[model samples]
Target: MLVRTGGPLAAVDPSEFTRTMARVPTPVTVVTTVDAAGRPWGFTASSFSSLSMDPPLVLVCPAKTASCHPAFVAADRFLVNVLSATQSDIAGRFARSGQDKFGDGDMVPSEEGLPGLAGAVARIACTLREVLDGGDHSILVGHVTSASVSGLDPLVYHDRRFTRPEPTPSLTTAG
Candidate 1:
């Protein structure tokens, strides 16, 4: 048996930890919402995951320095657009700063009026549930109001690059 101590888990350097974890693959997504002034705002993020299925909650962590951070924090409502493999360009567009991210995209509105990319693998509309204060970023938890899924492969992020899921071989028997 190995012994383990429970005292804040040995303060590992954050930069090193982040860089190390970035090596772990994650799914890429575009979180979108409208600001109080009704302008579309969005960001490409991989720090997103499903928190709960019962109450339908999801989490998206936007860095403090993100361009759309302010608008997202204020609106408290948003949509998680699960990008398809071919949507890597769109994700990159949103990730860039100093320009209107929604300018050259075909964004349509969800039932809640949040912007949803035309063809994502999945789109989840959510209302602000809670915002937890994290050191470098705020963990925004949203209660999913509605969700939709279109049949498509998801775009993934790994090794500091975008990736696509490879098709699996069918298990059908050939006589």
Candidate 2:
């Protein structure tokens, strides 16, 4: 069944929009960069995706109100550490504000001199390419300089909870 209202689209309720988006599954990642004083700053983000392959570009959205937003926007380089299923704790820690999120011993300095998590499923070192306005968030476009991946299941977020993908079942043919 379809209902036709020919005028204009109505604005969605913010709570409803958030609840709806919460149902969508997204990979968890911790985006990290070094501050001017060489201190590490990080925040958990799910709004990350590969934008292009020709120049090897990726984008991550950080809210304008985030405490580390200024550091990220001013940084020349950053690293995106794609969390593994075992990294839910790391995700939660970074998701919070006004704390030393890197107190845990899970981080190491990457070749690019940025913070990289040890058990991440993937790590992408990138140089800041562009910053675009995305409503209340900033779209950070990064030109990947180096990247690596591990054969681990990615941490996923859906319905406002952390989850992992179920393994696919094997199929057998009947003779």
lDDT of 2: 0.95
Per-prediction TM-score: 0.88, 0.90
For residues 1-175, could you state the per-residue lDDT of candidate 2 as single tens digits? 8998799889999999999999999999999999989989999999999999999999999999999999999999999999999999999999999788988878989749898987899999999999999999999999999999999999999999999989988988988
Error of 1 at 14 (Å): 3.8
Model 1 lDDT tens row, 1-175: 9987776666889899879987998889999988888888999999999999899999999999987889888876899999999999999998899987877756887759888887899998899999888788989999999989999999999878999877899889889
Quote the positional error of residue 12 for candidate 1 in Å.
Answer: 2.1
- Candidate 1 TM-score over all chains jointly: 0.88
lDDT measured at residue 5 in model 1 versus the true structure, 0 to 100: 78
Candidate 1 residue 74 C-alpha distance from true site, Å: 1.4
Distance from true location, Cα of 46 in model 2, Å: 0.6
Lowest summed-lDDT stretch of 10 residues in model 1?
Answer: 102-111
